[model samples]
Target: MAKSTLTPELAARFASIALGHVRREYPNKPDHTLAGPQDAQTPSQLHPVFYGSYDWHSCVHSYWMLARLLRLFPDLPVAADIRALFDEQFVAEKIAVECAYLAAPTARGFKRPYGWGWLLKLAEELALHDDRRWSERLRPLAEIFAQRFRDFLPLATYPVRVGTHFNTAFGLRMAMDYAVVTDDRDLAALLGETGRRWYGADADCPAWGEPSGDDFQSSALIEAECMRRLLPAEEFLPWFDRFLPRIAQREPATLFRPATVTDRSDGKIAHLDGLNLSRAWCWRSIASALPECDARRAIAEETADRHLAAGMPRIAGDYMGEHWLASFAVLALEA
Candidate 1:
C-alpha cells in the first residue's frame, strides 16, 4: 500500500470528525477534582472552550488538530467553519476562566504533563495562523502551562517511561515544539536540559514493556524522537545509536510491528490504534534524521508505512477511538 499522506481530502475528513465532537458536550469524562457541592458543574460550565470529545485533553488536541488543518489547508471548504469556531471559542473572557481553573489549588496537577504539553502545542499552532486573535487570547492559559513546566521539571528527577499520557518523554517532546516556535529561549534551554538529564544516559532500551493494555504511545520511539527534537543532530545521532543500536537488524522486533486493536469501542483497548499512529509519527521523524545511505533509514521508512497503513483505517469508527484517534493520525501523516 502507498504511504498515507495528509492531502486536503484527508484534512477535511479529519476536520469533520473533530468539528463533530469538539462541541458535543455529552458523554463526557472529566478529569476534574470537585472540592465540594458548589464545585459540581457541567463540563461546559467549567471548561467552556474544551468540554467535549470525551475529556479535556482529547478536546484540547482535537482543537490542535483543527488549528493545524486550517493552517495546512486554508482553502478547504471547512476552513471557514474552523475559523468561526475559533473566534467563538477563543474569546478573552472564556480563556480567562480556563486560566483561573488551572490556577485553582485543587487543579495543581489536573492534567499534568500530557495536557500541559498539548495546550502549549495548541498555542504554537494558533500563533502560526495569520490572525493573531486566537493566539493572543490563549496566551495566558499557555503561559500558565509553560510556567508549570518550569516549576515541575526541576522537581521531576525521573521520567515516566510509559506508553501513556503520563509519559514524561512525550510531554517534553510536545512542549519543545512550542518552546521553539515561541522563541522562549529560557523555556527551550530548560526543556533541553531536563530532557538530557532524564534520558541522556538511557542506553540500549529493551522495549520490553511496550503495547501495554492502555498505552497510546511507544515509550522507546518517543524517547528517541524527544532526543531528536531536543538535542542537536550530532549529539542525537550518537544517542540514537546507543539507544536502539539494532534498528537495522530490527532485533527489538516489536518496534517494527504495528500494534493490533481487537476492539475500537473499548476506550483503553482502543489506545492500541493510537499507539500504531504515534509509532508512525516517531518512525518518520527519526528516519528524517538519518542520512540517506544509512541502513536503518530504509527500515525506519518501511516500518512507518506499515504503521500508518494499520492505524489510518481506524481513525474514525466508534466514539471511543473516534474521539481522539485523528489527532495521532494527523501527527503521523504530517510528520
Candidate 2:
C-alpha cells in the first residue's frame, strides 16, 4: 500500500473526531489525587479547559491537532467550528483554574512530564496563529509547565527509558518544540544539555524491550527522534549511525515491524496501535534528518509506511483508542 499522507479531507476527518470529544467529558479516566474529603472534584471541575477526550493529556493534544489542522487547512469546512471551540475554552479565567489546580500540593505530579509536554505543544501551535488570542491566554499555564521542566531536569539524575508517559525522552521531545518556537534560549539550552546527559553515549541500541505489552511508544525510536530534534544534523547524524548502526539492514527487526493490536476495545492492548503510529512518526522524522540519498533513509521510510498502514485504519474503531489515537495518527501522517 502507498504511504498515507495528511490531506485536506483527512484533516477534516481528524478535526471532526477531536471536535466530537474535546468536550465529551464522559467515560473519563482521571489521574486525580484527592487530598481530602473536599477534594473529590469532577474532571471538568478540576480542569475546565482540558476535561475531555478521556484524560487531561489527550484533551491537550487533541486541541493541538485541531489548532494545527486549522492552520494547515484554514479553509477546511470545520474551521469555523474549530475557531468556536477555541473561543469557548481558551479563556483566561478557565486557564487560571487549571493553574490553581497545579499549584495544589496534592497535584505536584499530576500528569507530570507527559501532560506537561502536550500542554506546551498546544501552546506552541496556538502561538503560530498571530491573529488569534488563544496563545496569549494559555501562556500562563504553559509557563508553569515550562518551569516544571526547568525545575525537574536538574534533579533528574537518570532518565526514564520506558515506552510510556513517564519516558523522559518523549517529554523533552515534545517540550523542545515549544522552546525553540518561542526562542526560549534558557529552556532550549537546558533541554539540549539534559538530552545529551541522558542519551549522549548510547550506541548500538539492542531494542530488546520494544512493544512491551502496554507500550504506546517505541522507547528506542523516540529517544533517537528526541536527539534528532535537539542536535544539529552534523552532530545528530553521527550519533544516529552509532545508535542504530544496523538500520540499513533493519537488524533490530522489531523496530521495523508494526505491532499487533489484538483487541481495540481493551485500552491497554489498544496502546499497541498507538505504538505503531508513534513508531511511524519516529521513523519518518528520523529518515528526514538523514541524507536524502542514504540507503537508510529509504529503509526507514519504507518501514514507516508499513507501520502507518497497520495503525491508521484502527484509529476510530473503539472509544478505547478513539479519544487519543487520532493525535498519533496525525503525527504519523504529517511526519
Candidate 3:
C-alpha cells in the first residue's frame, strides 16, 4: 500500500517546524493546576525549560520528535541548529528548574502519566546518541518519571482507556521504551505486570465510537499495542484476534477509516488531526506484531496510510495544531 514517507527533506521540515515552538514561550496554552500564590506565575517561570509548544506535554513530545529526527537523519540540513538548541536547553541548571516545578505541592501530579511518559521517551531517544552526556543530564528527570510509573501503575485500578492525554496504554507503551533502553528492570517489570493486569483479559473491543473531537490517541489500538509489547507473538496473536475480532470484516468500521477534522482553529477539534497520526502509528505497530499471513496486516498498513494522509498535510498550518501535531505526524510516518 502507498504511504507518506519521512524523507530527509520531510525530516528537515518537521525538525524546523518543531524548533519554532519548543521555546516559543508566549501565546502559551499551559494546563497548569495552580493552587498557591506562587503557582499563579507564567508557565515558563514554573517549567523553565519546557514551558513552550502550547503546554508542557506538547513541549516534551516535540523535543522527543526533534531528538528522534536528528538521530534518524544526523546529516539533516538543520543538524547544527538542532545541536545548538539541545545545547541551549538541555543544561543541568535548566533541567533542575524543570524538576523543581514538580516539587510544588500544587504540581504533585503535574503531567501525570502522559507528560511523564513523554519525558522518559525523550530521554530514551537521547540515549541513542553516541554521546551519553545528554542522556545522563536528562536522567534526573527521566528517573523521576520512571519512578512515577513504578509507583502509579499498580494503584491505577482500571486502565485509562481513553483516546486522550491521560490514556494509560499510550503512557505504558512509551514508558516501556524508556525502561528497555535504560535497562530499568524495576520499571520494566512493573510496566509489564500492570499492563497485563489491566488488559490481559480484555477482548472483542468495540471501537466504533472514536475520534472524539479532542482525541489524539486511540484507546483500542493503543491497548492492543501495549499487549503486543508485553507478550510474545504466540500469546499476542490470539489475544489480538480476540481483542479486535473481525478485523477482516472491518466490523468496528471506525478503525478502518480516517477521522475528519471539522475545524483546525479549535485546538480541541484539531486533536482529530493528532488522532489520525497517532492511530497510524498504532496501526503500523499492530501490523508489525501480527502474523505475516494475517489478513489484518494488509488492512493495518492500508488504514495507516489513510490516517497518515488525513493528518500529515494539516500538521503545521494552524498554531493550535502546529504546537504539537508534527510530533505525532513524525511518529506515524516513521512507523
Q: What would the per-residue lDDT of candidate 3 be over residues 77-187, giving only the tens digit for each residue?
A: 888898988888888998998877777677667777799989999999999999778788888988888877777777789988788988888888899889999888888
Between the candidate structures 1 and 3, which one is better when assessed by TM-score?
1
Better of 1 and 3 by lDDT: 1
What does candidate 3 score on TM?
0.97
The 10-residue segment of model 2 with minimum total lDDT is: 123-132
- On the 0 to 100 scale, the lDDT of residue 207 in model 1 is 95
Task: Encode model 1's per-residue lDDT on 187-226: one tens digit a residue.
Answer: 9999999999999998998999887889899999999999
- The 0-to-1 C-alpha lDDT of every candidate, in the order given, reads 0.93, 0.93, 0.86
Candidate 1 TM-score versus the reference: 0.99
Candidate 1 lowest-lDDT run of ten: 1-10
TM-score of 2: 0.99
Q: Which stretches of candidate 1 lie over 4 Å from their true place?
A: none
Q: The CA-based lDDT of model 3 is what? A: 0.86
- Better candidate number, 2 or 3, judged by lDDT: 2
Instruction: Give candidates' CA RMSD values in order.
Output: 0.8, 0.8, 1.2
Report clashes for each candidate as comma-separated counts. 0, 0, 0
Can you give the TM-score per candidate against the true fold?
0.99, 0.99, 0.97
